[model samples]
Target: MPLTRRSVMDAAAARFGWRRAYGTTTEVDALLTEQSETAYTASASHAELATAKNHDALAVQPGVLDVRGRILADVLYLEGVLTGARNRGLPSEVIERLEDVVDHGHELTVLLADAVRATAAAHTAGR
Candidate 1:
């Protein structure tokens, strides 16, 4: 199966034991769940506003909306993990890895934004 955000995050959760140093897996899970929900809500709201403002080109693209939401959620989750890892004073290597993950997540957001802009420009030009 293609890797969805949840799957990647689940793998991350299982792979990282850093959370155990500061809190139970259950606590980490709860934090992730909350962050994911918040991210999704924010993404949906932004999508709706964009659509209402005649920027529905990106929204209408196949799989783009879902990917955007997933990216937002994944970034939020990774940010939470990174924060926790720092607060717990995890080893430098682990902290570095978490930082990398967070940075990659931000990169994904930038790519998605570029896609959205390209789609919008194309749509406008075709009008």
Candidate 2:
């Protein structure tokens, strides 16, 4: 389904436990708003934002109208691992891979953040 402002705000509210003003378009606007007003905004690019923040903990597309896609993806990954382990059906290799992923979740976030920042920087530069 196409993403909508309501859906994004609802997801944010559910995940962050923030009481959203339904259909008011506040959360969606905050995330989607352009960063043209901040002083020194050009100096600090999107890459900088990604580098400064924990991207893995944050959504993959933090600037998008929908900010929950990345978090939900991580949740799904965890669920898959849990299901595999619970069934004792996880292959040794798969289990080892999962262990690595779990252990490096933070690192993965950093990596993702860097990539995002780079993409943002390119986008900003092009415009």
Candidate 3:
């Protein structure tokens, strides 16, 4: 269930002729940049949410952190699909199929956080 670099690299090479000696470095570089950006964005959002010192700070607003997290999750899903498809040298149609199924696992994370914050607020107010 976990991802491995070797699997990703092997899949990419098998699909796209992506050998160190033969592949286009530009595509690989671009994919890595996108992935890193998504990860950094997600981290910043989570940090803001987790570092809040009081429940009030967490309430009365939609946390930018969760929105950012969802956006980043979507980006990561896309990156994985594109990287896998590119490595396999898949056709555009096939790549589109993969993209359709890419799972962005952030909605539930955001919902859970919201639920926790709401419970905390209700408890604080003696509800």
Candidate 4:
């Protein structure tokens, strides 16, 4: 079937909201590059957000939205710390460790979101 207006709106809005709100495409890409394997979780979270099916799984997407928002705060804070440390010429090891912190944070948020979505989907199916 062809997509409805609301469906189209939902997909585009969900993606734009995540990128513009939690991260910018360019910034996140650069972070991942600088972070190497340390940015895996953030990269995964970004990938999950890019999936339109994930958005359509929930009616409003509030659960994932909240999870992402909360995580974004912590991730951004950690990134800031890493940036400061790097600017000060801190060791690459220390910066990588900071990126690890951000990675764990992103992992936590994505896991929570997945759990919430699973519960929500089950509830909806049971009804």
lDDT of 2 by residue, 1-127 (tens): 2347656866888898786553446645653553344535665687777667744423445554133347446856875776678589767776777766765664555665666677677666766
Write model 1 residue lDDT over 46-125, tens digit each, in one string: 76665676545644554665788798898899899889999999999989998998898888888877877788787888
Q: Which scores greater on TM-score, model 1 or model 2?
A: 1
What TM-score does candidate 3 get on C-alpha atoms?
Answer: 0.30
lDDT of 4 by residue, 77-107 (tens): 8889888999999999978899899889988
- lDDT against the true structure, per candidate, is 0.75, 0.60, 0.63, 0.71
Across 1-127, the per-residue lDDT of candidate 3 in tens digits comes to: 1236645766888798774432566756766776799899878777566567346544534554566576667767677867888799999886776565454344445565676677567667874
Candidate with maximal lDDT: 1
Taking all chains together, the TM-score of candidate 2 against the true structure is: 0.27
Supply candidate 1's per-residue lDDT for 54: 51
* Index of the highest-TM-score prediction: 1
Clashing pairs for predicted structure model 4, backbone only: none
Q: CA shift at 54, candidate 2, in angstroms?
A: 18
Indicate the TM-score of model 4.
0.44
lDDT of 4: 0.71
Q: Count the backbone clashes (under 3 Å) in each candidate.
A: 0, 1, 5, 0
Candidate 1 to truth, TM: 0.52
